[model samples]
Target chain A: MNSLDELTHELFTFFNGFSSWENSVIKTSELSVSEAHAIEILGTHGQMKMKTLAGHLGVTTGTTTVTVDRLEKKDYARRESVKEDRRIHLITLTQKGQQAFAEHHQYHSNLTEQILSVLSNEENEQLINLLKKINAEAF
Target chain B: MNSLDELTHELFTFFNGFSSWENSVIKTSELSVSEAHAIEILGTHGQMKMKTLAGHLGVTTGTTTVTVDRLEKKDYARRESVKEDRRIHLITLTQKGQQAFAEHHQYHSNLTEQILSVLSNEENEQLINLLKKINAEAF
Candidate 1:
């Protein structure tokens, strides 16, 4: 029987390796992982408050502020204050940001295609099911 | 039939959520995710050169340099010059680093226990197999 420590260590190692692989493969353009993630959330959800974006990104509002600042400086995202509530800032991507997000999306597709090319249809279904199960547990 | 773009978007969302969940769960003693990862690699493979460490971290050597600088500043790692080749710098974790690694390992164990609490033995085995299959395709 494997010790709990051994098993957990193996899992952590696997998780880290998987994350590193995804990061390496998906990292293109000038975006950091967090930056790309911020873009992704914006692209999918459309415009959102900084706080909402931060909540989705799982970062503090302060961290989100900093990230947004950098993105804005790069012309990838913009912060627009609501006319009704000036204190609330809405963040949206620029055309350039949308282009970047689209390219990033393509990167993900190519990666998935590469993985799918190696697995049978049954394995693909199994993979998706397993991921859903794990994610459900994670939540 | 799912378009390649749609499939990729789903895959990216799945993995992104997974990564966020894992990050939220992993505990560290004054260590960020990157710092924890670097320490873990050093703990597993003691005394590696800068380039080798960069390769293990799946990051550029310049990035590894910055990570090492932070670790050394925190007294968790130290750099030693190779006698045969003085230009080569080997990075090894300090005793404090090892302690931190142990604590981090415990964090991972706690997380796994939490996850396993919600999974049956069969489900656990299935999850592992599915992850392995997906990872095999990732490379």
Candidate 2:
């Protein structure tokens, strides 16, 4: 059995590597990391309330408001008030935002492809399964 | 074969889930996320120069100097001058910093243990090896 200490060390090493890789990729993009993340989330999950977007981003609503405002100014996203709730603003990505998201996503796809290239098909399946299990419990 | 889009989507979903999990864990810690990260990196890798620490933390050296200053004030870390180079300072964790690092490490270990509990011994080994391979190339 793998000791907890060993497992933790390995987990952290992988975490650090993954983060650095992501950072390097994000650095190449035109959008700031935060902006790219916001656009990615909106693109993937579709429109959400500003508060909900903040929650998903793990940022304060005020910070989310500022980011969304910037996105709006850049024509990357838009804020709309629902008929039932003027107090709540639904944030949606603009066509330009969708394009940015798609471009940014290509970076992730390329990285994932490179990472998986070394594994056989069966190994790839096993790896994905293990990640799925761990994520299910961890999340 | 997983299409690029499918692979990218899966990778991102897993990334989002992992980040959210880490954020929740860090939120419960006494130190701010950045502070905790500094201590964790120091604790993991031993003492380092401020520039190197900032590199690992993915922040500017000026930002790191400010953070190290706060950590120094809090008695979590200390800076020492080397005999050959008085201009260069090495930052090391204090006893308090080590304790916090240990405590924070427990959160990671616990999460890892929970995730690994469901996997078989062979599966665990495979997962670790796969992570190691990916990390080596990705880093």
Candidate 3:
């Protein structure tokens, strides 16, 4: 590849590295990263079917089942059979689960605060706007 | 909190969720995400000392030692004593290691191509620029 292509590739790799590094830090959370992600989805969407949750998490239903099993074992999640569809299991956060989600949110808030702390208020706003734009495009 | 505050909080959570999801996908690489990250850094810097590598990876020296041990065992990396500074160990990638890094790079290339397939050229450029800005601010 040419020099510019190589540079772009390097930048892309660095971007991914930053993301990987952030995940490593988040793994230090009380819950595993996948478990934490499951909680966040449950917390946001309220009760959701196992299949739906798996789709949202971009993992297979089997992986979601294992994650839910771990969360349920930890008392952070509960599964209820849907009345209309016995085959569908709806998962929700227990009170303990809600608390865990709140703490996890706080962790993210602190991280955002730390990241924005270095920038000016105007820069922070720009950063947020840019992130939103990028996310929209990514989706 | 007010509605705006709540919305901001939700945005933060969503951003973090996306990050976790991306990390999970990247972890599917042959190397763990952490190992992949270390390799990326090594590939960029050519060679580095154990302490420097540990500092760059944001892990304890002992943990870095373990990771390096595994990488070396897998023949992706090697550790050499510095002639001038015998106490310091320099780590560098072997040809096999470079091939591994190249393969990892190809993975990202495929991801980027997939992303671009769905996005306009302008949107792709915007996404890249936005990511660069965010990394500068966050790191």
Which number leads on TM-score?
Answer: 2
Error of 3 at B2 (Å): 7.1
TM per model? 0.80, 0.92, 0.69
The candidate, 1 or 2, that scores higher on lDDT is 2
Among all windows of ten consecutive residues in candidate 2 chain B, which has the lowest summed lDDT? B1-10
| Candidate 1: CAPRI quality band | acceptable
TM-score of 2: 0.92
* Clash-forming residue pairs, model 1: none
Off by over 4 Å in 2: B1-3
Model 1 lDDT at residue B103? 79
Candidate 2 C-alpha lDDT tens digits along B27-138: 8866777888899899989999998999989999999998999899999999998999888999999999999998888888887887788889998898788777776665
Chain B alone, TM-score of each model?
0.77, 0.90, 0.77
Q: Residue B113 lDDT in model 3?
A: 59
DockQ values of all predictions: 0.42, 0.60, 0.20
User: What fraction of the true interface does each of the listed models get right, in terms of native contacts kept?
Assistant: 0.38, 0.54, 0.07
Per-residue accuracy of model 1 over B1-139 as CA lDDT, tens digit each: 4755555555565566657765774542578778888988898888899999999888789999999999999999999988999999999999999998787667667777776776778767765665566555456
For candidate 3, lDDT tens digit of each residue in A47-119?
Answer: 9999899988888999999999999999999999977878988899999999987877676566666555666
Clashing pairs in 3: none
- Model 2, residue B102: distance off in Å is 1.0
Model 2 Cα lDDT, one tens digit per residue, A1-139 = 4477777777778777767778787788667778878998898899999989998888999999889988999999999889998898899999999999888777777877887787778878887777767666646
